[model samples]
Target: MPSSVCIMEDPPVDRLTSPILKKYYPCPNASPGYFSLRHKFRSLFQLPRIHASELPVQQNKPVSPADALTAAAESLQKKVVQNKSLISEVEIQQFLSSETGSDRLKRMYTKDVDGFQSPELWFIGQSLLKICGMTFLITSYIGGKHGGEKFAKENQATAFRTQFQASRLRNDHVVLAGMKSGFIWTYRVGIFSSIFLFLSQSIAVYRNKSSVMEYVIASGVTGSLLKANLGPKGMMSGGVFGSLMGLVGGTLIYGFMLMTNETQEQRHYWNIQKYLEVQRELNKGGD
Candidate 1:
């Protein structure tokens, strides 16, 4: 049994050398502790080592057509909900009937009046007052003292006759003749004044460049001046020139007053109509 004694010892390091095995071996000059600790840490944690093929490749996510449509519908519904009561009829009516609305209407138009008010009386009074003042100025100032005296003397007889038979003055042949002449002159002045005022107001409205009241006043002044300068003379001379001016001035003034008043009233009516329209719209709902 003691024929052969085989020997077992560590393999020669130099004889077992290989390039791949070299990595597993410690460097000849390096400390073995450093490599030992690194190996121990890597083994303890078992940290994952990544490879290019193992990485997740990112790609754009696909959107379904139905999902997009659903999103659009949701957005549309949100908008509709937000604007649901935007044109409410009740709200519009309340706004129009409010104090603020009344104030605005007042500024744009005229006062709202109920019951009976005599526009006829207002026109007549304005006409007469304006005529009286105009007559005095033209006869006394513009006509000169001598012309004024002549007018007074001529009218003196008519004046006396009027005083005695005031009721008959409208019918008496002599007085009627005088009145006829006066009426002709008055008619001419009134017509001219009316034309001037109408044209002025119409132009202002058409252009929207000037205020209606401004044109009214201009027409008034111009009519008065024209009456004073170019008014007729002869039998109706005494204080009559200024009277003619007043007549014309009154015609324009009163006419304009009535016109503006009526216009304002119409505006108020129109606003009421607009309110009704808004109410109708609100009733329709969900536009």
Candidate 2:
């Protein structure tokens, strides 16, 4: 009789099908060589292997259109509320505080000043002062000229003719007549010019826009009106001259503002540099 042999064999473990390995490495048919290389890498890095059960499951629930819109609206409302909160009582108080007289005067020349009864009044006052002063100086100079003196004397004679004593007028009277003529001219030009300019600028400000065109239009209109007593040729010439002057003045002002802004930026940069230097010195001393 032949002897019978008994054999026992253990089943191979399917590591790729395990919950932990399957969660991390999804490929079930991966080669044993690849697994060995991964194991070597993990060992070299000394990385801890995390189990699938240790991770929390994250479910991506579908969002509805209405829900998305509601969320967006809520976010927008929150942002508006946050922005509103940024402007505080202290800021309002500071903005409303009284300004110095000199500061108010300065702003009158460039921008509308606060604490005034009316912005229009402020603009009117500024225009009056500037235009009147310029006109006074110009008319006085012109009146001192030879032709201007003769013209004034003629006017004085005409006036005194009603008294029947034209030749008997004093030197002081002639001088007074000349001054009177200058005053009349100054008033005519200055008052009308100021009114036109103020109206033009106010319109621009109201429209939330200001440009060289505003000045040009104002000056042209004022010049045309002033020369209306003369022929159309005079009116045209006056308008052209005024427009040219306005253009030159506006360009100069814009250039000046640009230079001022550049200077201010440079000053701010220097101030920051100085502050940084001081901070560094203090830190070094502390160390």
- lDDT string for model 1 (166-274, tens) is 4343335444344444555555655554555444444433332333453444454544555566454432342444445546765675477566764433444454555
Error of 2 at 54 (Å): 64
Return the top candidate by lDDT: 2
TM-score for candidate 2: 0.39
CA-lDDT, candidates in order: 0.49, 0.58
Name the regions of candidate 2 deviating beyond 4 angstroms: 1-115, 141-170, 230-234, 257-287
| Clash count per candidate | 3, 0
Query: Which tens-of-lDDT digit does each residue in 1-287 have in candidate 2?
Result: 11222111111245644576544555545655666666666568675889999999999999999999999999988986764324344543443344343443343345322234334355567878888877877776565554445755567535554444543444455566557767988888776767566756554443333456766777777777778789899899888887787788756754674667633234323433443445555665678
Per-residue lDDT value at 168 in model 1: 47
What is the lDDT for 36 in model 2?
64
C-alpha lDDT of candidate 2 relative to the true structure: 0.58
